[model samples]
Target: MNPLLQASPLPLFDQIQPEHIEPALDTLLRQAEDALSTVTAAEFPATWQAIAAELDVATEKLGVAWGSVSHLNAVADTPELRAAYNTCLPKVTEFWTRLGADERLYAKYKAIAPESLNTEQRQAHKNALRNFVLGGADLQGAERERFAAIQEQMAALSQLFSEHTLDATDAFSYYATREELTGVPDDVVQGARNAAQAEGKEGYKLTLKMPCYLPVMQFAKSSALRGTLYRAYVTRASDQAEDTAKQFDNTDTMRSILTLRKEEAALLGYPNFGALSVVTKMADSPTAVIRFLRDLAAKARPYGQQDVADMRAFAAEHLGLTDPQAWDWPYIGEKLKEARYSFSEQEVKQYFTLPKVLAGLFKIVETLFDVEITPDTAPVWNPNVSFYRLERVGPQGR
Candidate 1:
């Protein structure tokens, strides 16, 4: 049996292979389609529980299974896993598009009386009705068809964007001599050396991964080395990248995504995507959101300008950098922080071990919420992940 088909509460991550994806999704999608048909039939009653029991249960299983696949693809990507995900992407997108825009299902949801529902159910029912409109259920003929096509295109483009960025980040590496590493933290330099040795290469291996990149920006004394890494970091998956790296450029992908989003918004009677987006959110309209942001910026702009001015003065007087470039800001900021607080970031980091931090956090939460939290076992994609269970503390201590 496919591990994805197992009736476990949590995913069997260790057992779920790329090969299991197609068969598992095929079965789950078929079940969800059948459930949709069952619920939307004219003979079916327009009640929440009845519709939920048949449709919701099936769809929830599909959601969990697909979510597991997506999570693995994000955290532990491989060529085989990526191929499977891309192959199944369109099918999943198509099913969701069709389900959301199904007029029959929309009608059934519309007929569900709000008064018949409890407080939570009524809120969910209200959200469902709004989502139906936003999902293009109100569109007819060519417009509806175009909306569905747009959704599939957007999903494909989004996945492609992520792939391009990931590939670009993984592709580039720079080896620096010990002298070039200069003031960079010892642990980071040692890790880079270990990485180079593992690959049988010379010098310290440096990549765009945050762990190596951030410390170099903060503490490295070699400005030229920092500039090299900074340029590569900013140019990843863009047309501005080096010629060899241009294959992963997202220039056309980004343009296509924007165009489709605009078309999608228009099809649903929204002036722009932002207007359409806020319909389900707390903000009243796009104008209101924009106004709020502008007001916030106006209030914060003075302090921001003062900070920039202070950084500039400090850089000129202390660091001898009269004209600081984009790459120099983080280094300058770190220096300024050390001078002001009389403590380096690395100094503070030594006291907060992961185990101690988590233990303290758990104690605080348990005290505040009157709950007991315990470590629990589950299959995880990697050893770094942990699972926990929470239980309410009863008066009898049961």
Candidate 2:
């Protein structure tokens, strides 16, 4: 049996591979379709438990299996995995679009009278109805076809954007001498040195990855190094020929995403994408959400202004730096923190190693909750990945 189709308490991440993706998804999708057929049949039970146990259970398992593959593709991204994910993405999207637009399933749920159900079951039915409406359940002929096409296009565009962004980020590198790395953390310097040694290079190797870039901005004494990294980070997936490499450019992709989103919103009878987006969100409407954001900006404007002024003053007085640029902000901020708090970030970082941090986190959670959280060993795609099991503790010991 394929490990992807295994019946484990959790995902078999270690055993799952790019080759298993298509076969597993094909099997799962078929299973889900079969379950849907049974649930929408004439003789199927009208009760909530009957529908949920018979159909929802199988569908939920498929969702979980697919979710694990998606999650792995994001964090443990590789060329093979990316190809596999893209190949299966369209099939998954098409399956969902068809399932959502199924009037027969919607009719079955609608036929279940709410008065006969409990509070939870009744609320679940109501939610299901609302979702069905949003899923183009009532759309017919051309309109329904357009809606499904929009969904498929959106899925493909999203995957393309993600691939471009990741590829662009991974394509950059900045090798620097030891002297240029002044004020940077020892651990960061060590990490870069280790990377260079792996490639049998002379100087430390720096990449556009957050772990390497952040410390350089905050602590590297070389202004040129900081500027180089800043431009690379911001201009990723951009069409700037000089500042950026222009490879994996997503400028056109961004425009297409916005355009498609607006059309999708219009099809759904909403003013814009924002309005359609906030329907299932906490904000009641787009206008209210925009107002709330503007209010927050107003409240924080003074603090931001004060911080800028302080940084300007500190640069002029202490560092002999008159004009501070975008790249200088983090460096100046770090210096300001050290001066004001009587401590450096390097000093603070020494005590907060990963193991210690995890222990502290566990201690705090255990103190607050009635559940016991324990470290769990699992077969993971990445060595760094860790899992934990949370168990309920009653009066009697667990």
Candidate 3:
């Protein structure tokens, strides 16, 4: 989740205050557990139809609830909610792994005749079986235990990675005086001024946030200032200024997981993890994936090189530099674009206020899909909230 869910249309559980989440999640988890228990206790051999229909009820409810909470944890972040959600994710993941790896559950699901299911139901069972196998449902004794440990560690490490990224994002602050703001555009200067005023500070404030930091790099004439911002932005994820950099201690964790996965693939009689992973993917093989990437890379390489060469020429002529470093790219590129097109991105940004851009996008979608979008008259949450319901029309005027 990216701490910016303020702009999203979807409901968010993490932003709904701590008191609300526990009760909702508890109720939802209980409902899912009860459904799964009932399905497991049924005496008759499990058919795909019965299992698919029953499983969807439990998983779907849990999915919607967890999706909202996890999404909010990433975007519209709260420290307390992030802690609670991180605590809950392991339990939820373990539950899913256990349920999928359950021998009785797999027996019931695997017993169903393929032909007995409708297309969707058939696909559901196929997916269920696929997940079961992935969860080490078919493995026994040592291999299964190994797989479980691998999964648990991987989940923890992934969470750590995200937590570190968030920490890095929230760490730095930028302040500049009016004199320092000389080369910045008026709106950008105003934005920085507003930010500083918000914090009751004397001058402009900027941070790693794209909205604030990017404009200064793109338009600010001070090479030193641009270099400073660029360095801060790039180094944010390192251990120096970030508390969450501990999350990236996952190098060992990932290697351990990958090693176990490769072993698991071998036990299941696949050559490697890639072979195991792509079994259900469209590309079908690692060779196909590599070929696709290399082909696309080759096609783009010439154009990309030319762009680099043109930029180097422009920089050499204007800035008297033989080679342009990372910090020089944006400032130089802005000049080059203006030199060629007589148009600048900062100048064009006035017509693209967030609301107007959104409205124009909605208009385009409406034209293509023959749908209308209108704001909700009243809402429970934010005053900025909007709701839309879509309906598809028939071909004839019925």
Q: Please give each candidate's TM-score.
A: 0.96, 0.96, 0.84
Clashes of 2: 0
For residues 1-398, could you state the per-residue lDDT of candidate 1 as single tens digits? 89999999899998989999989999999999999999999999999999999999999999999999999999999999999999899999999999998999999999998889999999999889888888889999999999999999999999999999999999999999999999899999999999999999999999999999999999988888989999999999999999789999999999999999999998988899998888888999999999999999999999999999999999999989899988988999999999887879899888988888888999999999999889999999888899999888979783
Q: What residue pairs clash in candidate 3, if any at all?
A: 1-74, 1-75, 2-74, 2-75, 3-75, 4-75
Tell me the spans in candidate 3 whose CA falls farther than 4 Å from its real position: 1-15, 239-271, 367-372, 377-387, 396-398
lDDT, model 3: 0.73
- List the candidate numbers ranked by TM-score, top first: 1, 2, 3
Candidates' C-alpha lDDT: 0.94, 0.88, 0.73
- The 10-residue segment of model 2 with minimum total lDDT is 239-248
lDDT by residue (1-398, candidate 2, tens digit) is: 78879899888999999999989999999999999999999899877878899788878878888898899899899989988999999989988888888998999898997888999888788888888878888888998999899899989999999988898888888789999899899899999999999989989999999899999999988788899889888888888734556878888988988998998888888899998898788899988988999999999999999999999999889876699889988998998888888878788787999989988998788778877889989889888888888887879978
> How far in Å is the alpha carbon of 271 misplaced in model 3?
4.2
- Say which prediction, candidate 2 or candidate 3, comes out ahead on lDDT: 2
Q: Of the candidates numbered 1 and 2, which has the greater lDDT value?
A: 1
TM-score of 2: 0.96
Off by over 4 Å in 1: 367-371, 392-398
